[model samples]
Target chain A: MSEKIVQTSKEKQEETSQQISRQWKLSTSLGIMFLVIFMAITVLNTFAPDFMTFKVIGNFTVTYLYSVLLLYIASWSIVLYYVIKVTTLEGASI
Target chain B: MIEIPTAIGMVVLMVIITMGIAIFARRFGSSAAEFYVANRGITAFQNAISLGGSYMSAASFLGVAGLVWLYGYDGIWYASGFFGGYVVLLLWIAAPLRRFARYTVADFAFGRWHSKSLRMACIVFTLISMMFYVVPQMVGAGDLLGVLLGWDYTFAVVVSGILMTLYVVVGGMRGTTYNQIFLCIVLWSAMFITTILALMHYGWSYNALLGDIGARIEPGIWLDPLNSFALALGLVLGTAGLPHILIQYYTNPSGKAARWATVGVLFIIGTFYMMTPIVGFAGRAILGDAAGKNTVLPLLGQALGGEPLMGIIVGGAFAAIVSTTAALLIACTGAIAHDLYVGLINPEASDRKQVWIAKVSTIAIGLFTIGLGLAFKGYNVAFLVGLAFAITASTFFPMLFMGIWWKDMTDKGALAGLILGGASAILIITTNIMGMHTLQNPSIISVPLAFLAIYFVSKWAGKMPDDIDDIMHQMHSLHSDIK
Candidate 1:
């Protein structure tokens, strides 16, 4: 009898030659953002030390409130976008 | 005004209700599937509430306010980090994890390699990581009872452990889910009422509270951009990799359910985190360091509207600790039952027997955690939590990232990473616990060393598994055109 093939669920591990520079570019952007924020903290700490803690600037502190607000909104948006993208792609193909 | 005994009764009532739900939940989940994962049938709405209950542990409830009370504005970092971390989880592991692992975190790792060794290695890592992690929750439980009801610390530990174990042993996942959902509601309501009263007492204006905070404590520390950034990094990245959070993916009935539940989780967690700072800042303005920093919310209640509101907020604090501890107990027990005995020791164990094993293991782990809490009494709980995160991120993060994306990862490579990363983190933590100056002085050096060890060892092996290309395709599903 001919040799039988044993099929498994996992795909073989091979380097994709598609050469996606986009992933690297995105990573670099993230790194830069981290650096910028880090430097911003240093500068604020040095110059506007009093402003670094939570104080109401009318309704919010420019630093603490802004950072929290941005992080909060960005997190939710990313989750929603990722979920929708995956679900749509899965449905369209499968 | 409410008396102390009345507060104690409400708290006890909440605990009994939690136990009742857990015992009742077991009836529906007669099989292993039902027991471990609520049969993967929990709706996003219910799951989201349970997630809220789990997420807002003693750390969120007490830790944030206390940090704020002491450090002032610097404390918001905890809320930001804890909430934002889920975003990272959504990106890094969420949908794919649900799609890949039909069982445990180890099941996914082992499935990829067809290696029992890899599965066993993961089980050991999970246990080590979770034990240190759960100890802090137990400590928080003890502290909450000792302070609130004037109960002895040991009594609190035993009380919390016995109730949590009863629910988990009898109810399983179904029981845990319902208990968490109920507790989440009670916790949120207590927080809302307390915040409003505190604000009303100190003038119901955010601006007024901020002005008071500004006048009393110098905003010099809060305005620093770089420190804020570092805090953000810890909060976001740390939250993403927490094992309890990662396990939430398994609670979904389908991949679609995970996506929807994430949406619900986002709203719930975002609101909760945002509100924490309010209570923290409000406490600073109204209570004026009455009882202590950590007791900001409790003090604010009593200072603003006398003992009755204090009783309610105190009840909420109990809700927070119970919900979090109960969830951790279930998750850790599930990891043991699913990853250890069934996966490694007995692969063909029946569902009935598996449920029995889970129940027994739940109690065993609970008792051990109680002993740990009593031993580490009054230790810096927040810092201990950070140490747990450092260990988790170091060990599981590398193993998981490589296990999913890199097919060339070998058993030898995995074993090396597991031993190196897990051992290093454990060693550092043990040293810190023993008061070692060099190890505890700076986590930065040790944390990176753990990751570097994983990478270098995996590379030093020098040869990829022959089936590398096939694994890549499975992970990316490149063959399946996403139309």
Candidate 2:
């Protein structure tokens, strides 16, 4: 098998590859958004102790561990789920 | 506490309903997928609910409330740590494990390494960690049943064991997931109603009520900072490595479903966990010393609506225990069945046979847990879960993190880390804190040591593997290429 033959399929492969990477980007973006929320909580807690007592923000942060765990776990779970949905969507497109 | 007749009747009814669900769900197990990962056919919505149920275990139920009732403001760490742990789970673990491992956690362990020895190492560590997790649930069930229904501690263990085993054997993951979903809904409604009632009693001013309750309790116990940090660290880090929670990731039909489920799970778990502290704090203000620490929840409910409400509250706590217990049982059995029995013992076993083996193994483990529960009936629920968290954080967390991200992790290094992690954790549980004596300010001496051992051992294992870059690419690979 010539190297050229392998090289020739690269374009076709890239076509599919581009599609897949887009999904990964979406998942990664969602993941980072969740991290942002968690970081926000940490920042709020560090800078503002009184803020921790506010019912909306403070209540969530005061019970920070639960909110963090639930949010992060759910977010990651969403990413995995998106993988499945994307796979199925691609399969259908094919 | 509830009377004997009511308690026994409640116990019997709960058992019968659970068994019925198990038997009905048996039809879903005709195929291997149904048995193992529920055929990877579980919808994200169903899984999201199930995840919420599984994650919110005895800790969220009895422990948080009890701590709030006992320690006042300081107890919020229980809720905070648990929620925070999910962030670590999202960032470091979860999707990657689900994406890579097709079989079990053991399969993931063996994927990069060529050593059968390393595969066995992962299995043993997982089983040991899960066993620690199980004992507490069993003990909690026994204690709760005994107090609520006046059943002998032994009888409670036996009954709970039998019911758990029967369902796990017949329904497998399908049964476990559905049961978790059912149980979670019941628990959530119960807590919500209780919280609302508690708020209504004091005209719904959280600050006023908290202040009043804070006044009643001893000064330092209600709002200590250091205690919060340690509790937060344990709960936050512990979720990343839990055997059951990680295993649940594998059951998602597709990676997308798993991610979607995470979104729903966050909302459900986030809302419920927040409510736990509220319920606990309310109980503190209302019940006070007239009720024991664990009695805070039930007493408040009873005070709100007398016997009928009390029964419902107790029932909700019981439901919480059952859902988490069932999920743990399934996760532990998967470790034995998929990791050891199928992966190591009979590598060539057909999928059907593998499912059957899992069912049978679940029964055996269920029986074993019952014995441990009876033996440790007097122990505290939070204490047992913390020990579980410690062991898991020590052993599995490092292994999972390093195994996925670090290419240089050798068989010898992993084995050493796991053994050291588990042994040191067990030593801490047994010697530094016997039974449940030191639960209040539990010793976390072993936690840092476990992480340190893995880091140093892996560093010494030598240069990175030749395929390190390839593995990294696989992890960072774009979904479009696979699509």
Tell me how far the alpha carbon of residue B243 in candidate 2 is from the true structure, in angstroms, after superposition: 0.3
Model 2 lDDT at residue A77: 62
Worst 10 residues of 2 chain B by lDDT: B474-483
| Local accuracy of candidate 1 as per-residue lDDT tens digits, B287-348 | 66665655777777777766777777777787777677777777677678877888778878
Error of 2 at A85 (Å): 16
lDDT score for residue B41 of model 1:
76
Instruction: Provide the overall lDDT of each model, using Cα atoms, as 2-decimal numbers.
Output: 0.66, 0.66
Model 1 segments more than 4 A misplaced: A1-56, B1-3, B215-235, B305-308, B427-447, B462-483
The number of the candidate with the highest TM-score is 1
Error of 1 at A51 (Å): 7.8
Write down the worst ten-residue block by lDDT for model 1 chain B: B474-483
